[model samples]
Target: MSSRISTTRVHEAGIETLQKRQVELAGAQERLTSGKRVAKASDDPAAAARAERALAGEMRAQTSERAVEASRTAMSLSETAMGDVVELLQQAREAMVAAGNASYTDNERRGLAEKLTSIRQQLLSVANRTDGAGSFLFGGQGAGSAPFVDAAGGVQYRGIAGERRTEPATDLPLTINGDGVFMTSLTGNGVFQTSAAAGVTQAWIDNGQVSDPSALTGSTYTLQFSIAAGATTYAVLENGLPTAVTAAPYVSGRDITVDGQTFRISGAPASGDQFTVQPSTATLSVFDTLDRAIGQLGTPSRTAAQIAQGNTDALRDLDQSMSQLQGARAAAGEMLVRIDSETGRLADQKLANQSERSRAEDLDMTDAISKFQNLQTGYDAALKSYSMVQRLSLFQYLNT
Candidate 1:
């Protein structure tokens, strides 16, 4: 069956076609303007989520990069400071050698002592060094103030024994403890320092070097010498508890091994003379070592033997101190390397994340422009076709 065609229906269809073309043109315009393929979440939810996650990780990497920078600065400062300590100790050793010359008078020795005193003060200043923000560098966890303080005999370490580490990467420690750098003691001699007990004048004591550092128990020990059976004998005490039932024979020029540490006793001693041994702790003050050097080289009326012992002990202690500084410098260098490596890794990661995010969210400008032009041409063709269709009539088509 044939039905009559309505002109209104044709015009309506043409209008609908124009409207659809207009919507397409609007969407193409939006993409070109915004420079993003998915400006709205509904455009591509999964792609949006991927881009968001990548951007978040990039932010975290940027934060870690900042931390690495700070760690690098800190490590640099530590390395330089340790270098300064090494130089100062070397100077002190050279001064000790000069003081040993017999040709130098007592006044000359006093002059050398004054120089050493100045050096000790300088060492104290170094010990109390601070970072750029005025925080103590060697304060361990106690960064509030100076770590070393003035005490009765010499300077003492007032800082806590620990470290502050930075996490530039997961589970990585980027800082070293101050105790490890400042207070490293090996076993042999100087396991404990020696001094003449109160009310005793028959013997002079020198703080020996550590021979075997690992076996020390950090306990207090005492050595008391007495004359028995026409021989000098000494008793050992550990923390005020008797270590032996009877005194051991004191032999001159023999090494006394106690608690895995070896100490030497030489020369004649009076009855009731005593010496004490204090266990080495995890930390030692560079200033204390310097102060001892100054005292040893400065004191007047020191006998030749006493002077010789002091020089020997000072040299040994200074060598150990140098080792400590070197170790610290090496540690700082290693941390610097870690920071640099991590920073490079973070930079590369950020670049990759940026690329990923771009792929997920950013528009391809060339493709977007091309699409806009194509849609514009299509819209123009639709408008022209719609105009032609509107002018068409049933009689006109039948005649053609």
Candidate 2:
């Protein structure tokens, strides 16, 4: 097949070869400049798709990081506020203890009451603390304004009763429940409450404890004392029904066990004096506890027995409020710990996403530069060959 090649065909073929080489060189230069293996979907469809997915994952990780930051700020503020609340409650407890000193005059007790009132106001402020962005730390889910407000009855929580969380893959709390922190504490000893009858100044009852959890019936119990025939005796009544311990010898400051509860009643009691014990199911407000203690301390006409009873009850209630506040603070601390854990996890996830994106689309600089140089050399050689072929003529070739 010895066919002579035409100049027109040769010129067209040489031009096409140069154009193809230039295009390849340009593509290599573009890749090197952009530092990306797949600049567009046309370059590598599968690699581009993988890079897109990785980029989306990176964005999500960034969003989660932002959420975690917001949650951390809010929870840190809340935890600090809870700590302040605990400190204020402890101060109130100290004031209550000072008020219990029998040597303190009525005026001295009133001064302690004033101190407690101040602490109460401080506690309310802590409960309504903000995140510096017009949001409350203990606002629960949400609130239009302040969460806790001082009303005529006492301090009340107006916020929702649950926590608010950040919006991201890692859900984190932004607020704590004001109601749980400040309103919903158990009364008395957390099991049962004991109280002397009104006008029974001769005797006082101590806060009772549970002796046997299985024997508890949650029934109301009444202890009636009788001074008959020069002997002191007491009778136990369970929900107004007489028990087998009728006319038991009355001993002052002796432990009296009924059902599953145990308590002590000190001082002499006249005939028909009564004390009641009931289950501690009632909710006690921290503010109400402080108010009662203040009122008791401010009263100057209370007998010794009455004062002792008031002190006992006030201390018990204060301890309960402190317990509740401590629990809430502990919860806030735990939330902060969780936030830290989530932060570390999100950081690792973000790093992984970045690595995946780099693997999918990022160019290897060393390999890319070498390939670009090779492409440049090939394009230059093609240009030189085209020039030499263009100079070739039929007469010059025949003379040679």
| TM-score for each predicted model, relative to the true structure | 0.78, 0.94
Error of 2 at 214 (Å): 2.4
Error of 2 at 91 (Å): 1.4
Q: Top lDDT: which candidate number?
A: 2
lDDT by residue for model 1 (182-221), tens = 6555422435655556554335555555676677788888
Candidates' C-alpha lDDT: 0.74, 0.88
* The best candidate in terms of TM-score: 2
Error of 1 at 61 (Å): 0.6
| Candidate 1 RMSD to the correct structure | 4.3
| Error at 259, model 1, angstroms | 6.8
Clashing pairs in 2: none
